[model samples]
Target: MKTQIEQIKVKNFRLYRDLHITDLQRLNVFLGANGSGKTTFFKVFNFLSTCLKDNVTVAVNREGGFKELITRNSDPEKNFIEFEIKFRNFEQGEKSPLVTYHLKIGFNHGKVFIDKEVLKYRRGQRGKPWHFLDYSKGIGSAIKNEQDYDPKSKEIREDQPLGAEDILALKGLGQFERYKTIKSFRTLLEQWLVSNLQNEEMRKIGDVGADQQLSMSGNNLAQVASFIHEYHPDIFQTILTKMKQRVPGIDKVDIAINEAGQILLKFGDNSFTAPFISKYTSDGTIKMFAYLVLLHDPTPRPLLCIEEPENYLYPTLLRELAAELREYAVRGGQVFVSTHSPDFVDALQIEELFLVKKEQNQGCSHIFSAKKYDDGQISELYDNGCELGWLWQHDYFKGINP
Candidate 1:
């Protein structure tokens, strides 16, 4: 089943004082009201991506340094930030093994540095997990040959020293192919596509002739559209087909390279013989088309974090959008979506849904799966036509304001 992270734990990072999310599915839906930590939760991936793509220092600095990144004013009792991921790896149609990577960092002497980091996995059916890679403050060794396992002792340990204590060991060592585990984890982090699509940005022209993948904030929409249309025509056609089905009066989407060699996106409405430029298209149309393009990319990302996909899209399309996200997951990419729309939530199954809420007084949060409810109870309620969104609206859920 390839490699998929089954669980994640966060401590002293952003709004989550300490949070553990488990039983993660391919198509995970995170439901929460305003200020319930949905965006904060997504920030965890942002922090990790920055660390892997750039460095820990850059990650910290980008988030306004440790002072701003820490959760709830860094309780004197808890002074460090930590994140842990437990994932399952599979190869050749069989489950390979379970692996866990844990990272802890502390801010000291006007700087943030790695206090501890470890990558370990279970060696056999029943036994203590082996620590294949262990490092502290950029000093330590990692296992070279990850496949060779004698089960009693370590094999081929290689000393690794990063250029700086503020650097992430995985970021430095993950470049090599021999360290399969490190490389895989790094790829997942680096390839994560987090969307904060701005409609205004999507309307502008992008740099010339860039083999563009969708950017994190989705500003390179035109360039990405150009890339797909020019390189992967089939995928682009699929996007156009879906776009026409969901969006009204959008027969054709034209992409042209101007004299400056920049790509421009134009919309062709049936009402007009001339095509309308991106800026002239309706917000909902542009947003939905961007989503279709993203979901149908030729090289799908390992993880896609889209916050509030319901925004700017027709309420009626929410259900179809939910199904499309799930389809993307089934087609081999994991999806994480946070939404406030009941229409979108209505389309989700019990196992794929999570309710996230925060306590009023303490500002602490609880994220629980909807699957915790009894199956018979669900069968009875759903059989009676009691939809999940209707239930949510009627105060069936606690801590959420609806």
Candidate 2:
């Protein structure tokens, strides 16, 4: 089934006191300056999805725990971060339906805890009554116990409340036994939402072994390529062909697993195979390979979030990347990318571009469509010769005559 994130709303979460994001298309792009809370916003969604699928421990560890993650100006008595995400879940051979999920986490006695969680399926433009998945202040197992005692009387007791563990057990049982749809959604997030930063140091060293499935920080690109070669040879060949078109000098790409169990990329020379070292590879080449490894993989993820995709790529390649991202979205994979690259934005549809800006002393963030502002000047710039990054630099958004 195809799935895509439709919207996200955040409250009292790190640099953002309040953030409402409604402009979400298949290929959504967030553009903001450094330290303007762009990555933090992505982190919030990542943390929430991880916590729901795995555990609080995994989420906290990924974000440096409560002290580092919690909002600096958070109220001492009620230090909490809340977010809501709306997603479209497609059924097999059927069109997808919109589903909204809400989550809240807070610090309690120095331990991070989920305060509230709810999932709902929307019928139309308005949201339906939420199916309460996990509510901190709700009658949980006590009601279950009551139901077990008397089958006819399906009434919940108000006074007899379930403890935390009991509530969690009931929720787990509900996911495991009763409701398969919610369980499927949870599983999707757990499996597809890969955070490479979990092993950042190892990835940077390019020491990832040959048999690894996915690269930590894209260091295992060769390993992934090798896996593709052995298992999905057709996809690997297709990627190589496409890459050769982009990079003229590259005759062919191959992954060689050496005796020491290290995987390396071997470029075909006129007469022999030349081993290309990852560390010595150009940044553009490395980034291109990393992206190809993900895109051409046989297993498709429902949603993929990439941070700063413009980090190491030429402006021309950024345009190609943007086009490929669009194709990925068209094929039913939701792609959310955060970038400040104008070339990348120029290659996208105006509706797919979202402008993220921070208002001084507003204690919140604003997201607006680049086309909806002032009769679509931003879109016009992209339609013309101006690149997105340069337009912003020239104060084009500030009503200046750039």
Best by lDDT: 1
Q: What is candidate 2's lDDT per residue for 1-402, written digit by digit as tens?
A: 477677888877667777777768888887776666767777775766666555665677687766666667667347667788887666533555566777776776666656766665533455343342435643432222221322233333223343442122223533553444456467556545433422222224333354435543665666667778888889888888877877656667766556766666766534445645555556666667677777765766677777877776788888888888777777766777888777786677777877777665654566667767557777777788776667766777662221
Best by TM-score: 1
Q: Which ten-residue region of model 1 has the weakest summed lDDT? A: 373-382
What's each prediction's TM-score? Answer: 0.93, 0.80
User: Please, what are the lDDT tens digits per residue for candidate 1 over residues 26-134?
Assistant: 8898888888889988888988988877778889999987888887757523498999999876642465677899999888778778888898887676766767678
Q: Give me the runs in candidate 1 sitting further than 4 Å from their true place.
A: 76-78, 150-154, 373-385
Against the reference, the lDDT scores of all candidates come to: 0.82, 0.63
- Cα deviation in Å at residue 314, candidate 1? 1.0
